[model samples]
Target: MNIFLINPPNCGRSIPEERYGITSLKQIFRGEPLALEELAGNLLEHNVRILDLKADPDGLDRELREFPPDVVGITGVTCEANTVLQLAVKVKEACRAIVVIGGIHASNDPGFFNHAAVDYIVVGIGKKAFADLVCALESDTDASALPGVMRTRPGRALERPPLRNTVADLVVEHSPNYELVSRYRSHYILEKLGITMGFVASAFGCPHRCLFCSIQGQTGGGYLTKPIETVVRDIGLLVDIPVIRLVDANTFGDVKRATALGRALFESGLKRQYLADIRSDTVVRHPEMLRQWQEAGLRAVIIGFEEIDDASLLAMNKANKASMNAEAIAILNDLGITIVGDFIISPDYDEDDFDRLGTYLDTRRIDLPMITVMTPLPGTALYLQEHHRIINHNLDYYTLTNAVTTTKLAEERFYSRYAALLANSHQNARL
Candidate 1:
């Protein structure tokens, strides 16, 4: 069977890719469609093609008309819901193909895509389930029985249970078909390093219970990891790319496991730098572990210093103090590793709060300070607690740059202040 997968164009947030830069946000944030790349790897028996709309948005109609695959699969986040649906409609109009949609958006809100063009939905970890679904489609068999899949039929939606295991098992045997996306290699770049990059998932899920986080809800609140050997092998396969970004929710969620992976990479004889996310407490507890990775080409660590106030930290159930964030920043600075600090700007923030945040980042001299307005994303504890307060239900506005709830400051004034902060941070960023 012929298969085609697409990564939809960026929508929702006007936030910059490296929130501290003047470059076009789209250029900085354009990533290779790793989801499509993995799906292509799983469907190795079939002819597969991928089109990342970020790289070429106008090519979709052309591909649908020219290639005319047997199956057209699309994956997107909550913000890309409308865009994916529209793409599905266009694919159905252009070709005699089945449209299957997956990813966090489709999984969380299956009912929203009650369109006739959407033939199927894969809800959870999609590696094996997707391959199985494809085989069933090829054989013209009943697909409702497949795990982690939902089939659309006349006046009915067929459902199945989610897979009990994680995709780490598959990562051991197969890496994303990075070669398929070789044409758009220059588009997938790391802003800090200013070079081409590849994404590798070292682990899955997060064990922490931050109130605003949706990872626990998505992954059944459990953490799973690939073997160190598997991770090293995946990194080696990505040798063509200079930088590798571990797109894990928490690469250091398990300190010991992370340390083992770092040791393996250091000894692997591969000359690739890496970037990953780390919790403040993890850095505080294991600075030396990061030091080892630094020697092994760990360029920077993205830390979510969510808030500056202890009370706010406790409210979010971040399980760490403001002091820990400061300490972690100091440690990374001392280690000579770049730090990408992410902070949430609550909708309730007044002019005073914005000023305070600016002062904090300036005082710390954070390398790249990324800011976002606090959004109550669906499936998160914060969403459940503040569902009634959500004035905007449009997924596009939930990009974290826009306020979906009421704000203390006027919307115009709030955005102006936010824009000012981004410009100021860029000017202050270390050259």
Candidate 2:
């Protein structure tokens, strides 16, 4: 089968930019679409071509006309859900290919893509499931019974399959087809440092279920890791890339496995710097594991210190405390590992709340403070709890920087404060 895997373009509308003319708040995503590449890797028997619309936004129509694939797979996040459907329509209009939509958004809300444009919706870690789906389609067999895959039915509730997120679903044996995106390699760079970066998924999903998190949809609330050797091999494949972001929700969820992986990376001497997500509690409990990883070229750790207070943390079901977050920052600083700290700003914040958060960031030694609005993304616990308050139903503004719910303060004032906080926090940002 001739398959075309598409990575959606830099999408998601910013409310601040669109409504208040706050241009600085709009986000521009830059990275290789590792998900699509992984799916292509498993479809080695087919002629696969990856069209990264992010790198070449105008190449889609040309590729469709020239390649004319038999199967078209599209992947995207919550904010890109609408755009993914539009792309699906374009593909449907251009060719006779079966359109499949998978990724964070589709996995979370499979029914959202059950329109005529999309034939199937893949719900979880889709490498193996997608391969099975492609095989079924090519052989004219029924694929509706595949686990973690749903045959789209418009205006009807989707019958979701039991998510089979075991290690087999990872299919780590076949490394991601990195060469498929080689032409877009130079476009994948660390914006701050202007150095090339590659993505290598050492793990998937997250152990913790923060109320506002969407990662659980990827693996049905399971934590799965690739073998250390597989991880090392994936990193090695990006030969010239200097930085490798282990694009896992939580890379060090399994402390023992993470420790061994660190030792293995150290032994393999891959010599590539890594940036990975680790919970603050993980850092507090297993500081030595981080130490070993730091020695294994772990340059930075992205920790989600979502809130500054315990009450807020508990409300969000973070299962962590502010003290743990502070201590982890100190420990990472002591170990010389740059900290890329993530902080969430609630729409319910008042003047005092903003002042308090700003004061907290001023006192912390975090290398980079990434602050985002407290968005109640659909399919998250927070969304369920706050759905009644959502005023913006548009998926385009679900960019995390936008508040889908009503703000405690005036709308424009809330965005102004957010923009100001971002500007102030980024004044001395690093890493």
Candidate 3:
């Protein structure tokens, strides 16, 4: 069976443009489609290939004409749902291949892809389900009984167990097929660091219950760490890249496991730099562990100090307080680990709020401050609570940079301040 995986062209708001200056937007962000690589790894026995549309948009038609895949699998996030659907339509029109859509978005809301173009939906952990589907297709057998695989038939929507149930044994033995994306190395970069980068998933899902986050729902409200040996093996596969970005939502969710992985990496004597994310509360509780990691090639950390004030933190159910966030910043600074501090702007933010936030970032000396408008993404508790308030159904604006809810400040004032915040950060970032 010939299977092709595609990372559909991105249509969502660009993270770098919103946080980092637009000058570095294209340079800093464009990551390799690591998810497609993993799915490719699982189907090693088949004629498998991947196409990252961001790297080569025109290549899709060329690949379809020449390779002619029997099955085409596409993945995307909520903000890219429209793009994903359109791409599926294009694939169906161009080739007679079975179209399967799976990713965080599909895992959370599979019903959206129950259109004429999409034949199957692989929810939750898709490696096993996808591989099984390919095998069944090759043998001309029905694959609807497989866990996490949903088949769309006329007048009927086949159901599987809740998305989370399929992830209980998600840690597969196969490493990602990094060789498939080797041609696009230069296209995937961390511009601020000015280096070629590779991605490794050391863990999956976060343990936290932040109301605004959809990750907890994805991981069945628990944490799963890939075995340390497996992570090391995965890193070894990407020997061509100099920097390895741990792409887990929370790399240090389980501090003990994370420390063990760090120690293993340090002992292995790899010279590559590393980056990962963790919670503010974790830093407060495990400052010493972070110190150990700093010596283990840990160059930077992306942390959510979601809100700077106590009331806002409490309202968001962040667990950590404002003082804890400050302490975490102090600890990261003392360790000399570069900090990518993340903050959220509420729709209620006025000029005073923006000024206060700017002052706080300056006082803390954050290496890179990433700010976003608080968005109630679907599958999150916040969405369930505030779905009524979500005036905009356009997923494009739900990118966290755009406000879907009414604002306390006038829309013009809110947007201008947001732009001003970005401009101010670019000036400070140079320092």
Candidate 4:
């Protein structure tokens, strides 16, 4: 089947891309290409062609018109939902193709599938969720029966049992499909410093229930770990790649697993450089474990240091305090691990608060703390509670850096403060 997998024009990242030629943060803003690319390889057995639209330079209409696929699948994010809906509407109007949307956004909030243009909505892990959706679409079967899916029928809507959220048993082949891994080798090269980056998913769930985060709730809490050897063998697939990235909600969620994974990476002779995102509290829980990861090839960490003040911390449901972020930075930096820190400067903070954060970034010696306007995505608690306060409903404005809501600081000061942080991120990358 001819399949057109699109990353879509990142409406959320548009402002930043226009300003700096990069979306998200400069260092780790490579965007979420790895998941889609990997899914493509997993899908090749189905004889479907996959395209990474994020890396594509062609104009939207030009590409869609040129090569219409039997199905056009979009990985949905809250910030990108509006764009996805509009694009799906256009594609359906222009061609006879089924449209599907998946990813965390659809999984957390399947209601998005109500879009008439969307033929099927896949939830949960893409590997199984997508395959089932494709089979139903291709066979003209009752797609509503497919697990982890929601679809509309002639007069009623059909919602199916979410696929048993199992991380194991999904791998059809004994091999970890590198089909997706190979698509963006060049991009990983730059991120890993001319080294290829392999995706290594060690765990599936987060134990922490941060209100602002949907991960813990989505994965249903406990950390699901693969065999240490399986983890080792996965890295072996990317031994040729310069870097191995752990795509866990929190790879280091389990210290024993983290240590074993690190040990395996070291033993496999593939531990030159690795990267992953994990919370500061998790890191503090096991200092030696991180040291082992560093010894095993961990060069940097992408942490969620959301805010520095106690009230801000409590409001976000972050659970961890500002002090944890600071302590984590100190420990990790002392251990020689580079941290690509992330923080959201919301309407909740005044100019003084922002000034305090800026000073904290410098005083803490945070190499690159990527600061952003607190973005209330559609599915998150932030959006639900504060939807009325959101300044702009346009999905494009939800780009983490955009002030979708009136922040404590005005638009000008917020942007100016962000500009300073961006400079710091660039400087940190060089350092």
Candidate 5:
């Protein structure tokens, strides 16, 4: 069977840009479709090809005409959910292939994709579940019984089998078929450093449930780590890529596993730099582990310093404190490891709030301060708590940079401040 996996294009409408003409706040993401690559790796028994719309947005129609796949799988985030449906329509019009939707959005809100254009939705970690789906499709058997696989029932609730995600769901043995995106390799560069970077999943599903976080939907609030050997092999498969971003919600969620993986990387003599996500508390508690990782060519760490105050931190249910975030910043700086700090701006921000956050970023040693508007994404605790306040129901404006709720300040003023903050913070971004 011919399988075609697609990564949605750089999408999502930016309120600041579209409304206030604040272009600085609009983000353009660039990366290999690692999720699609992972699913393709498991479907090696069948002919598979990847169409990275992020790299080649116009190539979709051409590819559909050329390959004419039997199964077309589309993956995207919440903001791209609407676009995924549009693409599904295009696929249906162009070919007789079955349309499947999966990825972060579908995994969290499976019912959203239960449209006539979509035939199935693979929830949770789809590496193994998607393979099982393919097999069922090939045999012309009922796939509705498969765990994490849902048959679309438009205008109705989607009832799926309970998926108890375990280590097997990762299917690390197959390794991501990185070669599938070889043609788009040059497009996957780290724009800040202008160097090629590859993604390798070291861990999945964060242990801590930050209210605003959607990672728990990936594995139903479980922390699973890929074997150290598997991680090493995946990095090795990238071959010529100089930097490897450990694309995990929290790379050090399991300190012991992270410590062992750090040691393994050191022993393997891979000589490649790595960037990974870590919690502030993890760094404060295990400074020694971070030091070990630094020695193993850990160049940078992305820390979620969501807020500058403990009260706001608690509001978001972020277990770590602002003090811990500051301490972690100091530790990483001392270790000569770059810090990519992630900060969230609330729509309730007044002049004083914006000033305080700006002051905090100005004083911090974060090499790259990534600031985003506080968004209550669907299928999150925050969303459940704040859904009533949502004014914009359109998924297109669900980009983290947009505030779907009413702002404490005037809407235009709110976006102006956001644009200013982003422009000021990125002035000295190093990585």
Candidate 6:
């Protein structure tokens, strides 16, 4: 089977949906296109080839015209819906290949199957679903029967289970299929950023039930994680890679596992740096774990210090740790791990929040890469709650890099402040 996977164009000046301003910080790193690559690797057992559009979108048309693949896979998030819409048309126009679209955006909303360009939609983790789709295509089976998929028929949409039965093993033993990315490396960010490709996930599912998050609805509202040894092994395998971002919704949710992974990697002499999310309460439970992670060369922690004041924190349901946010930062700083605090700056936050937050970071010298403008995303608790009031229903704008909310604060005021924050940061850092 012949296959192609794409990372659609990211044209926003900010991170998708304006979630956070860390886009300017290369250190925070753009998410690697590992999902499609992993999906590609899984397909390789069947003599299928995967092409990365991220590495080469321009050459894609030429390649598609030449190879005329039996199947093409495109992965995307909310931000890429617009691009995917056009790209899908272009794919079909270029060739008669079957098209499969998968990602968070597609998974949460099964409506993508209705698109004329899509033959099948893989709604869950791409590797397992792609493997099934490839087999179905090879044998000419009814592809809709595959799990986590929904096939478009004459006038009907068939839904399959989109949940990964064993999410922990999705990226196991996977390589980026560099040959594929190389074909399109002209557009690939990894080569330019000097970052080697690696998995960004250690866990899946969100339990917080935040009103604005879509993760739970997409992944089935539970959690999954790999053993610490698996993580250590993965790290050891990527020692030559500059970094391995733990892309878990709760990267360090399992304190013992993360601690063990850190110590094991450090003692293993793997010099590669690591980055991940750290829950405020979780990390505070074991301060020594911070040092353990740092000793393992942890460079940064993308932590949720979301709301500052008591009322706002309570409203945000972010009182998970009460006052532990402050404690977590102090500990991580003492241990020499860069504190890349993640916050949802809202109108509810008064000057005290900024003053205290700024003073805390300054005193600790924590790298506050961004104070994100919180926007409710589909499937997130916020979306489930306030979605009725959302003026914008465009899933494509839900990239977290733009403000898509008609929130407690006026939309214009919220966005303008966010835009000004970006401008001010740009003036200072010019990232």
The local distance difference test score of each candidate is 0.81, 0.92, 0.82, 0.68, 0.92, 0.64
TM-score of each: 0.93, 0.99, 0.94, 0.86, 0.99, 0.83
User: Which residue pairs clash in candidate 5?
Assistant: none
- Expressed as tens digits, the lDDT of each residue in 321-416 for candidate 2 is 999998999999999999999999999999899999989988889889998888888888988999899999999988899988889999899889
lDDT score at residue 365, model 1, on the 0-100 scale: 61
Clashes (candidate 3): 0
lDDT rank, highest first?
A: 2, 5, 3, 1, 4, 6
Clashing pairs in 3: none
Could you say which candidate leads in lDDT?
2
Q: Against the true structure, candidate 5 has what lDDT?
A: 0.92
Which scores higher on TM-score, 4 or 6?
A: 4
Q: Give the per-residue lDDT of model 5 (tens digit) for 1-431.
A: 99999999999998877777888887897889999999999998999999999899899989998898999999999999999999999999999999999999998888889999999999899899999999999999999988899999888888877796899999989999998999999999999789999999989898898999989989988999999999999998999889999999999999999999999999998999999999999999999999999999999999999999999999999987888998999998998999999999999999999999999989888899988888888999999999999999899988898999999999999988888887898888897
In the range 1-431, model 1's lDDT, one tens digit per residue, is 98999999877644333333423322236788877887787887998999888888788988877787999899988788888999999888888899999877766566667678898888756777788889999998988877777887646654545555475524457777888888888888766557888998878778899998867634567788878887887788776788888988899998998999888889987978888999999999999999999988998889999999899999999999999999998899899998888899898999999999989877886888888778888767898998999988988666777778987887667777787887787675651
lDDT of 6 by residue, 1-431 (tens): 66667677653334332544333422223445766766776776654555545444476667676677878777777667767777888889888888888887777765754688888877756667778778888898887666677776536655555356466436565643444454443332343346554554566765565555667644666766766666666555543566667777777666766777777778887687777777788778887887777778787778877765566667777656547877877787677677766767653444444456555444444464566666776546676766676677666555565555554545444445555554443342210
- What's the CA error at residue 168 for candidate 1, in Å? 6.1
Cα-based lDDT at residue 360, candidate 5: 90
Better of 3 and 4 by lDDT: 3
lDDT of 4 by residue, 6-44 (tens): 776535644435544444342224543544554565665
For residue 276, model 3's alpha carbon misses the true position, in angstroms, by 0.5
* Model 3 worst lDDT window (10 residues): 19-28
Candidate 1: segments with Cα more than 4 A from true spot: 13-28, 153-160, 167-171
On lDDT, who's better, 5 or 6? Answer: 5
Q: Specify the poorest-scoring 10-residue window by lDDT in model 1.
A: 19-28
